[model samples]
Target: MSVQDYTSRLSDPASRKMGTFSYLPEMTKDQIRKQVEWVVKHGWNPAIEHTEPQFAMSNYWYMWKLPMFGEIDVDAIIAELDACHAANPGNHVRFVGYNNFTQSQGANMVVYRGIPV
Candidate 1:
């Protein structure tokens, strides 16, 4: 599916937004495939991983999914995420899976991750 179609699926109100951070809210499997069609799509910066909410979808239950993105400007990405947060309230972004306290054998953290548009 195209980005527009993929977005439509994510916005499906009946699907119940769980408000956990992972990939883009509107991202789809096909969208990911297309997004990666070009050779070596870059993340610019690494993704901010986060855990799924307690009541999230089955796919998010126990697995840690890393979202990839294409080339994008950092400022633009941040601004977009901020806008998403404003529109979606608290579901648009989050941070998790990292341990800042200890640098020894620490688990990753989750946060609002961005992918190239």
Candidate 2:
């Protein structure tokens, strides 16, 4: 079956408890910056990941690039996010805040969603 067909048959929920403010509406740019700042202040590294539209419902996602640890600059992070979005305009992009103390646990938030044509 085509990936689109498989995706169409999936029944994922509209909302997921992924990030700190995920229970609320999708955050604005300012809000996102605040969250990123908080994460950086707490010594967490930020990372970006995305999945193409065809695999939006899949558990697997491709990393946009390496994690941005030790980089407290929010603009740089946002720039990377924008770059990723520009590169994959038809994909679902998300931000991940990785905590070293957690070993393998991290907070995730969807940052950009490309509308299907």
Best by lDDT: 2
Worst 10 residues of 2 by lDDT: 4-13
Off by over 4 Å in 1: 1-68, 95-117
lDDT of each: 0.34, 0.75
Estimated TM-score per prediction?
A: 0.28, 0.76
Among all windows of 10 consecutive residues in model 1, the one with the lowest summed lDDT is 103-112
Model 2 error, position 52 (Å): 1.5
The residue-level lDDT of candidate 1 at 101 comes to 38
- After aligning candidate 2 to the native by TM-score, how far in Å is the CA of 7 from where it should be? 17
Across 1-117, the per-residue lDDT of candidate 1 in tens digits comes to 655332324345343443422334655534433332321223232233233333233444332235224424444333443454455442324322222234221222223332212
Task: Point to the candidate with the largest TM-score.
Answer: 2
The residue-by-residue lDDT of candidate 2 on 33-59, one tens digit each, is 887787788888899998865565656
